[model samples]
Target chain A: MSEPRFSVGQRVQIADRTPPVHHRVPSYAKGHVGVVERVCGMHANPELCIRGDGKPFQRIYRVRIPQTDLWAPYEGTDGDKLEIEIFEHWLELAQ
Target chain B: MTGHDDHDHGRTFQPDHPEPTSDAALVGLALRELLIEGGHYTAEEELAVIAEMQGASPENGGKIVARAWTDPEYKKRLLINGKDSIKELGFDLEPYEFTVMENTDQVHNVIVCTLCSCYPRALLGMSPAWYKSRNYRSRVVREPRAVLSEFGVDLSDDVDVRVHDSTAELRYMVLPQRPAGTDNWSEDDLAALITRDSLIGTQRDLSTK
Candidate 1:
């Protein structure tokens, strides 16, 4: 019964660490900073649930990250953004 | 009407990648027959489900979008609770919750499933092959504006582009801005302009027609 770590509009960073197997967290988002757009509710972690192992539901958030921050050579417009759903455990409060 | 003796087997043989050549089809047929014989699920039920899925298409989503365009209250309800609002149209949205992202004059929205190809199948039917391609999955987030331009949706630098990745159970659809010069157009006329790609946020100018 842990409380949600991040709030809407709060800045956070996805953990850069790689897991042993496939995960929902995309590689492009790792180590990138974003702001929580919406609290999308708790859901079973696919990494564990897909393996048929019973796991606790984790808080999911819709995080909005600037496209420029994600790709170093990104030449898109400045206002472009990329939003991804991230699990609470995979995110940490951005410095 | 050609005889088997006259058929050239060598010509049909593929080298690098061989086709299944009915072997896989036979196995699938056998498995399906076994399942039906075991009463696991009736063949009728399977056909009914297939028919139900076939009945679903972008038209369903188009109807919703058309209604939202003319009715402000329904639009508000759709934005607040997408699943329930869609259910109001007598459609069942199961397994995944649905969300509608609004495309205003200043901001536009696009959807992608970076993990796997998750989408609003109940409303919009199957996603296009391009939506599931690795090229799209890898580039859209990194270069949204560029990717959109390839789809013929060019936006000004001032307008913001938002990309929503379907990482969870929730599914998203875009509510594109209503086209102009069709103020008094019927619901059917308005719905006709909403294309499958338009619902995905790839094309913005629906007024072209």
Candidate 2:
């Protein structure tokens, strides 16, 4: 079993690559930075699972991105947040 | 009714749209018949599973929330292990991760799945059409407070609003605080007040005094 790449509260950024097939990462979340809120359990890449690709699994993390960071015209207060479940393969440690 | 049918003549009624069948539905129908023909399972057994699905309504979630409200230990267990805690109540939330996000006086929480319509169908049955709408999927994550206000949930500015986007495999449900006036209410009574929207965090006011 592979160890989780990121921990809760760690800063990470979503990878910007565009896969040709189905993937869990949303277009809106691509290339964005967020804080890991929870290390949700590991699971096979849903894109592969749907295709019966028989690929190994990776850890899924719940990352909390601030609304203001996601949208420049965000109207809510500063503390507002949007949390998304992202797989470990799509994330990298932020500087 | 027979006289009315005679007046309508031998012509059968034809609606504008033919029941709006989709490719997915047709595929599902074919798969079911194929499975039955192969002797994998009888149609009667399939109906039993259908019956089980019919029982997967928000009422089960209400029972969990109500129990959590009355039992502190149960609430802790739910926060830590939502799947196991729900199973303790004889509810099945299998093949998915069930996470309970608690709403406290300091903060408010709402759930949305921005990527496709992933939800806790085993616990809440089919998600409302609005929950699956593209407009909602896009707007809620960007403007949760504004969207929530449209649902008649206007939290004060001081309270932080957190919108959870269930983008991947896990599913989320809100664990709203027990309303103030319901301190003396029984578990069953409290469960009655729990709305599907509240379980999803679109609404929080559950006081029934």
Candidate 2's clash total is 0
lDDT of 1: 0.83
What would the per-residue lDDT of candidate 2 be over residues B1-209, giving only the tens digit for each residue?
23333432112222232442788866766776677658797666766676677668898889999999999999999998787888999886676788999999978999998878888877887799999999998889878888999999998878889998888778889998888777899999999989999989999888685
For candidate 1, the clash count comes to: 0
Q: Rate the local accuracy (lDDT) of all candidates.
A: 0.83, 0.84
Model 1: which residue pairs collide?
Answer: none
lDDT of 2 by residue, A26-46 (tens): 888899999999887778787
Question: Tens-digit lDDT track for model 1 on A5-49?
Answer: 889999999999888866788887889999998876677777787
Give me the candidate number with maximum TM-score: 2
How much DockQ does model 2 earn? 0.76
> Predicted chain A of model 1: TM-score relative to the true chain A?
0.90
lDDT of 1 by residue, B1-209 (tens): 23436643322222243434687765766776677658797666776776677778999999999999999999999998888899988876765678899999999999998888888887999889999999997777777888999999988977899999888778999999998788899999899888999899888878746
In Å, residue A86's CA in model 1 sits off its true spot by 1.1
**What's the TM-score of chain A alone for every prediction?**
0.90, 0.92
